[model samples]
Target: MSFIGIDLGTSSVKAVLVDDRQRVLATAARELTITRPAPLWSEQAPADWVAATLETLRRLKDTAPEAFRRCAGIGLSGQMHGAVLLDARDEPLRPCILWNDGRATAECAEIETGEPASRAITGNIAMPGFTAPKLLWVRKHEPDIFRRTRKVLLPKAYLRLVLTGDAIEEMSDASGTLWLDTGRRDWSDRMLAATGLDRSHMPALVEGSQAAGRMRPELARELGFDAPPLFAGGAGDNAAGAVGLGAVDPGSSFLSLGTSGVLWRTTAGFEPRAGSAVHAFCHALPGRWHQMSVHLSAAASLSWWSSMSGQSEAALLGELGGQIDRPSPVIFTPYLSGERTPHNDPQLRAGFLGLGHDTDRKAMTRAVLEGVAFAFRDGKEALEDGTSPIGEAMAIGGGARSDTWLAILADVLNLPLRRYRQAEAGAAFGAARLARLACTGESPEAVCAPPSGEADIFRPHPDRAAAYAERHALWRRAAEVSHALR
Candidate 1:
C-alpha cells in the first residue's frame, strides 16, 4: 500500500507520494500568491488553495501512476492559524486571513481582555497571527461576513472538508486558535465565548494520526484510486514537520527555517510560558506536547532582499563565498512581517544599521544571514526558560540548505546543528507518516523512525563565538529601535 501527504504552505502547495516502505517515490508542487490589500493585511482566496492542491495531486499521480493507484491513506498538513470562514452552504465568506497578517493587533488585546485567563487556557499568548483573533477582526471590520459564518476551519481543515466531506481538525492545528485548552487537548468554551463563538462554529476534533474520514468516492475515482483512501487528521505544518523528523520523544529538538523560522522542542507534558511569548501547543501524536519560539520571517527576508536587489538568493549568497570568521559590521532586524516569539509586536518593522559607504552587497548579504541567526538565538534563549535546554538540533527547511547560514546559526546560538538526508521533504513527509499510521494502526514509534543515513553536523566555531555574541548584542539594540518605529 502507499500513502499520500499534502502540505498546504504559504507560498505553495506540495504533495508527496510515499510507499509502505516510507520512501518518497514522487512529489509535485504549485506556487501560490498572497494578496496584501492593505499594509498589514495578508490573505488568499480559498479557491486558490483548492486549485493548487488539486493540480499538485494530479502531477504527483502522473509522476507515479501505480503508487498513486495503490494509495491507502491521505494526510493533510498546512500553514497554521489561517482563518477560513464558511457559510451554511460551506462556501467561503471571504478570502482566508493568513498567519502573517497583522490586521488583528487590536483584536488580540480584545481576546485577552474578554478572556482574562486566555494565556493559561490556550498555553499561548493571543497574537495577531492566531486564528481566533483573526475571527474577531472579521467580526468588527467585516461584520456581514462574520454574521454569515456558520463554520470556521483552519487552512488544512477546509481542504479536508473538500476532500472527505467532513469538517475535521486535529490537536496541533486547533491549539493555535486561542480557543483550544491546549493542556487538556480540547476546545475551551470560555475562550470561544471571548470571540462570541461556540462549539457549533468549530470542526470535529481528532488526533493527528487518527482516521478522520475517507475521501469522497467521486473524487477518489477522478484521481484513479481503486477505493476512497482513509483520511488522517494531519497537523499544523511545524508539528507535522516534527513528526516527519521523528522528534516525538521529550527533549528532542529541531529548527525549521522555511518562510517562518521556529526553534521547537517536544515536551513530556503541558508547559505554558506565555510571559516569555513562547508557544506551547499539542503535538500531532496523542499524549504529546511541544513548545516553540517562532519568528515570522526567516527565508522570507532573503526572498524580499533578493526581489528588491534583482539578485537571486543563490547569486547573493555566492558573493559571501563561505562562512566568515567575523560578524558583518551591518546589523539587520528580520521583522519584515511584524514579528512573534519573544516580542509579539505586530507593528515592529525591519531595519538595517551600521551601513557605511564601504559596505557592499557581500556585507549586506552577510548581515542578512547573521541577523536571522541572532533572531534564532533570541528564540533559543526564550525556549531555555530554566529547563528544556536544547543541546543540539536537527536543521530542516529551505534555508537550512545554506552551509554558510548554518555555520552562522551554529556559532550564534553556540549549539550544534545536524542536517539529515531528505530534510527538505519536511511536513509533507510527516503527513504521509500520519497517513500510514492511520491506515495500518501501527504504533507511532514503530512507524515514525528517523530517516536512515549518516547525518551532517555543523559544530560551532569556538574561535568566532565571542565575536558573534558581541554582534548579537548590537542586533538586540537594533530590534529595540525597531519596536519604537511603530
Candidate 2:
C-alpha cells in the first residue's frame, strides 16, 4: 500500500507520494496567491486550494503512476488557523481568512476580555492569527454571511470535504483555533462561546493519524482509483514538519523556517505555558503534545529584501559564507508582519538600525538574515522555562537552503543543526508519513524512525556563539523600543 499527503501551505499546495516502505516516490506542488483587500487583510479563495490540490495530485500521478496505482490512504496538512466558513449547502461563505491576516486584532482582544480563563483553556495567547478571532470578526461585521454559516473548516480540512465529503478536523490543526482546550485535546466550550460559536459549528474531531473518512466515490472514479482511499486526519504545517523530521518524541526538536519561523519540540505530556506566550498545542500523534515559539516572518523578510534590493536571495546569501570576524553592525528587525513568539504584538514593524557609510548590500543582507536568526533565539529563550532541553535540532525550510543562515542559526542557538535530503519537502512529506501510520498499524516510532541518509551536521562556532549571546540581549531590548512603531 502507498500513501499520499497533501499540504495546503500559505503560498502553495504540495502533494507527496510515498510507498509502503516509507520512501518518497513522487511529489508535486502548485503556487497560490494571497489577496490583500485591506491594509492587514490576507485572504484566498477556498476554491483555489481545491484546484491546487487536484492539479498537484494529477501532477503526482503523472510523475509516478505506479505509486498512485496502489494508493491506500491520503492525509492532509495545511496552514493552521485559517477560518473557512460554509453555508447550509456547504458552499464557502467568503474568501478564507489566512493565518497571517492581522485585521482581527481587536477581535482577539475582545475574546481575551470576554473569556477570563482563556490562557488556562487554550494554552495560547489571544492573537489575530487565530481562527476564532476571524470568526468573531465575521459575526460582528458580516452578519448576513455569519448567519448562514453552517460549518467552519481549516485550510486543508476544506479539501477533506471535497475529497471525502466529510467535515472533520484533526487535533494538531485545530489546536491553533483559540477554541480548543490544549490540555484536554478537545474544543473548549467557554472559548467557542467567546467567539459566538458552539459545538454545532465545529467539525468531528480526530487525531492526526486516525481515519477521517473514505474518498468520495465519484471523485475516486474520476481520478481512476480502483478503491476509496482512506482519508487520514492530518496536521498543521509546524506539527507536520516535526513528523517529517522524525521529531515525534520528547526532546526531539526542529527549527523550521517557512513563510514563518518555528522552533518546535515534541513532549510526552500536554503542558500549557501561555504565561510566557509559548504555544502549547496537541501534537499530531495521540497522547503527545508540543511547545512552539513562532517568528511571524522568516523567509518572507528575505524575499522582501530581495525584491527591494535588486539581488536574488540566493545571489545575496551566496556571498555570506566563509569566516566572519564579527556579526554585522547593521541590525535589522525582520518584523514585516509583526511578531508572535514573545511580544505577541501584531503592530510591530521591522527597521534597520546602526547603519554606517560602509553598510552595503552584503551587510544589509547579512543583517536581514541575522535578524531573523535573532528572532529565533528570542523564541528559544521564551521556551527556556520549559522542562525539556533540545539537543541537535534539524533545520528545514526555504531559508535552510542557505548554509550561512543555518550556520548563523546554530551559532546563535549554541546547538548543532542537521540538514536532511528533504529540506524543501516540509509539511507534505510529514502528512504522508501520518498517512502511512493510519493506513498501516505501524507505531509512530516504527514509521518515523531515525534518518536513513547521512545528514550534514553544522556545529556552532564557540566565539561567534559568545558574540551572539551579547548581541541577542541588545536585540531583545531593541524589540521593546521598536514596539513604539506600532
Q: Backbone collision count in every prediction?
A: 0, 0
Give per-model TM-scores.
0.99, 0.97
- Residue range 1-486, candidate 1, lDDT tens digits: 999999999999999999988989999999999999999999999899999998988998899999999899999999999999999999999999999999999999999988899998998999999999999888998899999999999999999999889999999999998999999999899999999899999999999999999999999999899899999999999999999999999999999999999999999899998988999999999999999999999999999889988999999999888868899888899999988989999898998899898988888888888888999999999999788579999999999999999999999999999999876799999999999999999999998887679988899998898889987887898989998897
* Candidate 2 residue pairs that clash: none
Worst 10-residue lDDT window for candidate 2 reads 317-326
Off by over 4 Å in 2: 321-323, 386-388
lDDT of 2 at 17: 92
The deviation in Å at residue 361 for candidate 1 is 0.4
Worst 10-residue stretch by lDDT in candidate 1?
Answer: 447-456
Compose the digit string of candidate 2's lDDT tens values, residues 1-486.
Answer: 888989999988988998877778898989999999998889999999999998998888898887796799998999999999999999998999998888898998899899989988888989889999999999999999999998999988888998899999999989999989988999999998998889999999999999999899888888867688998898999998888878888878889988899998888888887877789999999999999999899999998999999888888887776545578888889898888888887789998988888789888988898899999988888887646467778889888887788888899889899998865677888899888888887899888774667787889999999998898888877777778778
